[model samples]
Target: MGSGVLCIAESAGNELKKSAFELAGVGQRLAGALGGPISGALVGEGISGLVEGLGKRGLPKVYVVDDAALGRYTSDGYAIALKAVVQAADPAVILLASSAMGKDLGPALAARLGCGIISDAIALEVVDGKVHATRPVFAGKAQLEVEPADLPVVVSVRPNVFEPAASGDGAAETVAVDADLTGEQIRVVVKELLEPEERTIDLTEADIIVSGGRGLKGPEHFHLIEELAAVLGGVVGASRAVVDAGWRPHTEQVGQTGKTVSPKLYVACGISGAIQHLAGMSSSKCIVAVNKDPEAPVFKVADYGIVGDVFEVLPELIKAVKEKKGL
Candidate 1:
C-alpha cells in the first residue's frame, strides 16, 4: 500500500481556491502521521501556474493535467484526469474539499479506483496509520467516527472546517501527466458557463454568515439581511422556507438539504430554528439568534438570544455594527 497523501487542488480562473490550501494542510498532517510525503494533483486548462502555490502550501511534488478539454469542469473529464494522477502517485489517502465539484467528482473517482469514499468530513485523524473521519449524522444531532476498511481511501472534507496551510517559499516539482479523455467518455458536455453578474463570498467559505428565515415577512424585506451581512463583512444565507417561497435562491439556503456551514459567527434573524436548519449552522463558533418567540428552538443553541421583532432588532443591530466599525 502506498503511504503518501495526495491533495486534489481546486481552482477558479487561474487562482487556487482557499479550500485547496485547506486540503494541503490536511494532506501535510496526514502525510506526517503516515511517515510519507505529501503531493498535489492539479487538473484544469491553463492551471499549471497554480503548482507553485501548492508548493508554498508544503507539497513538494505536484502532478498537473492541463488540457483544453478540461477548460470547463465535467464529472467524467475530471474523474479520468484525476485517475491518471492517482495511478502515477499511487497514494494511500486522497483529500478533497467538499465543494460542489468535489461532491460530484469524489464518488466517481472512487468508483473508478474501487476505493472507499467518505464525504463531508468535519474532522480527520490518523489512527493506526488509517484515516478516521468524524462526521455529523441524524441532522447534526449525533456524531459518527468512521474509517474506510481499505488503504486507498477518498475523503471529502467540509469547507472552512479546517485551517489552510501556512504559506512558504519552497518550490514544487511539476509532473505533467497526460489526460486520456475521449469524447465518448464524457456523455454530457457543458456548452457555456454562466456566472452571477455580481459575485458574493460563497456561503460555505464565508467566515461570518447572516441568515434570514420566514419571519422576515416577505422577500422584498431581505434588504435588511443583506445590509447586516454587508456591515459585518459576511455573506447572506437563507432558510429552506425562504428558498422554497422563492424569497431567495437555493444557493443561499443553509440547512440539511442545503449547504452545511461552520462560520466563525452565525446570526439567525426571524428564523425559527428548525432541526434541519440547526443541523447546518450549529457547528458555527458563535451563534446569535433573534426571534420574537422566546422559546424558539434556535435559542437553544444560540450563544446569545434576542427576544424581539426582527424588523426592530435588525436595524439597531446594523447601526451598532456600523458604529463599531466606525463606518
Candidate 2:
C-alpha cells in the first residue's frame, strides 16, 4: 500500500483557490482513515509564500516546486512538477479540484504515473484501506462509485461540494523539490494568459445564483437577471436555450451541456426547468422558481414558486430584496 494522501493545490495570482482548502480537508480525512499524515503539493512560480497558509490548513508537510517556467500554467510543466512530488511522497491517493487546470493535468499526471483516475468526484471515503469515490454519471442522472485497481489512485473532486478545512494552530513542514524539466520536455509553451473582460464569481464557486431563461423575452432583458443577482450579491446564470439563441454567452449556461453548479440558493426566473437544466443545479440547497406557467416542471422541485410573468415580477422582487437588505 502507498503511504499518505497528497492533495494538489491550485492557485491564481499567487493566492490559493478555494478548492485547495477543500482538498486539504479531504486529504486530512483520508489520511486519518489510512493511518498516515496529510500532505500537499504546490506547483507555480514564487509559491513559497503560500506554504505557511497551507501548513495552518491541516497539512503536516507541503512539497513546493517554485520555478520561473511554471509562472504560467502549461500542461507539460505542471505535470512534470507534480510527477516529482508524487515520486517523493509515494501517496496512496491523490486529490485535485475539478477545475480547468485539474481537468487538464489530472489525466496527464495519471497517465504518467500509470494509475487509474476517478474524475469529478463528489464524495470520497476509505473503505478497508481503499479509496472509494462517488461521482455523477450518465449526464448527472445517476451516481457511480469507483475504486482504483492499483495504489496511488488519482481523484478530481467537483468544486463547492466539500467545505474547506479550518486553519490549524501549527505550521506545516515545507519541502523544496526540483522537477528537473528541460525545455525539450515541455512540448507546449504558453504565450499569454487572456482574462475575461468582466470577472465574477465562477458558477461552481458561487454560493447563490440567479438564472433566467426565454421567458425574459430578449437578450437585452438579461439586465433584469443581472440586477437581481447584484442585489442578492450572487452571480448570474442562464438556461441553455438562452445561450443557444445567442441571448447570453455559453459561460453563463447552466445545464447538462454546460457547467454544473451546486449553490446555496438557485433562483430560476422565467425558466421551465428542463431535465437537462435540472441536472446542473438540482443539487442546490434551496430553489426559488418564478414563471408564468404554474405547471412548469421547475415548480415541482422548487422550494418557493410564483406563478407570474418575469418582467412584472422581477422588478417587484428586486425592490423587495433591496428593501429587505436595506441596500
Candidate 3:
C-alpha cells in the first residue's frame, strides 16, 4: 500500500475544528494500514497557525493555500485549490469533514478530479485493495457500502463520530501554494454567512444532548430544557415542529433538514420522534424519552422510556440528576 492519506482541515472563528483533527486521526490510521504517512491540507486566508493543531494529531505535512480571495468560502475556488493539492500529493484516499463547507467542497473536488465520491461516510476501511465506504441510504433507514473504482477516493466523515487521536510530537512542514484560481473566474458569490449561536455547543459536537418538542407547549418552556442541559453539561436541541413554530431557532433543530448527532446519550423530552427526527439522532449510543403518550415513537428507539407529562417528568429528572451528582 504505497498510497498515502490526505485529510482536509477546516478552520473558522479562529479555532481548529475538532472534526478536522478527528478525520486526520482516522486518516492516520488508514495511512498506517496502507503503509504510508498521513498528511493534512488547509486552505484559507491567514490560516498558517491552524497547522500546529493538525500537526499534533500526527499529521506530517500540511499544505496551505492562503489567498485573500479564499477569505470567504466558495465551492468553485476551494474545489479548484483542493484539486490542485490533491493532484500534487497523489494520495489514494482523501478525507474531509461533513460540514456545510465540506459538503459543497468535497463533491466539487471529486468532480474536478474525475473521481468517484462518497458523502457522509460514517465508516471507512480498506476492501479488496480499494476504499470501502459505509453511508446511510434510504434517508438513514439503511446502509450502503460504496466501492469507488477510481483513484483518490473522496470521503466526508460526519462530525463528532470519530474522536481526535492523542497527540504526538509531530511537527508540520508547510507547503505554500497560490490560490490557482481567481474570484472573477468563479461563478457563485457568497454575500454573507448567517453564523450559528457561538455560546451554545453545536448539536453535532455535543457529547450529551437534551431535546425538546411540542410537549413543551411554548417557547418559554425551553427554559426547563436549558436548565437540564446546563446540569448535564450538554446542549439543548429542538424538534422540527418547535423550530417551525418559531419557539426555537432553526439552528437548534435536529432532524433530516438539520444537523445529525451521535452523542453518548440523548434525552428527548416531549418529542414524539418523527421519522425525520429519528433519522438524525437515532445513531446516538443511548436514548432516553419522556412523553405523556405511551404510544409515542420516541419510546420505540429509547433505551429508557418514561410515560408521563414532560413538565412533571423533566423537573423530577433534573432533581434526580442533581442529587446524584451532589449538586
Most TM-score-accurate candidate: 1
Pairs of residues at least 3 apart in sequence or in different chains that clash in candidate 2: none
Residue 326 error, candidate 2, Å: 1.5
Any idea what lDDT model 3 has?
0.86
lDDT of 2 by residue, 1-327 (tens): 668899999988778888899999988998999998789999999999998889889887999999999889899999999999999898988999988788899999999999999999989999997888899887667899988888888899988888899988869898998899788898898897778788888888899999999999998998999999999999999999999999988889998888888888999999999989998888788999999998999998899999999999999999999999999
All candidates' lDDT scores?
Answer: 0.93, 0.91, 0.86
Q: Model 1 — which ten-residue stretch has the worst lDDT?
A: 179-188
Instruction: List clash counts for every candidate, in order.
Output: 0, 0, 0
lDDT of 3 by residue, 107-186 (tens): 89998888878898888887665678888877678999888777678899888777687778878889886657775777
* Cα lDDT for residue 48, candidate 2: 93
TM-score of each: 0.97, 0.94, 0.95
105-163 per-residue lDDT for model 1 (tens digits)? 99999998999999889999999877899988899998999998987999999988898
Could you tell which candidate, 2 or 3, scores higher by lDDT? 2
Error of 1 at 62 (Å): 0.8
Who is ahead in lDDT, 1 or 2?
Answer: 1
Candidate 3 TM-score over all chains jointly? 0.95
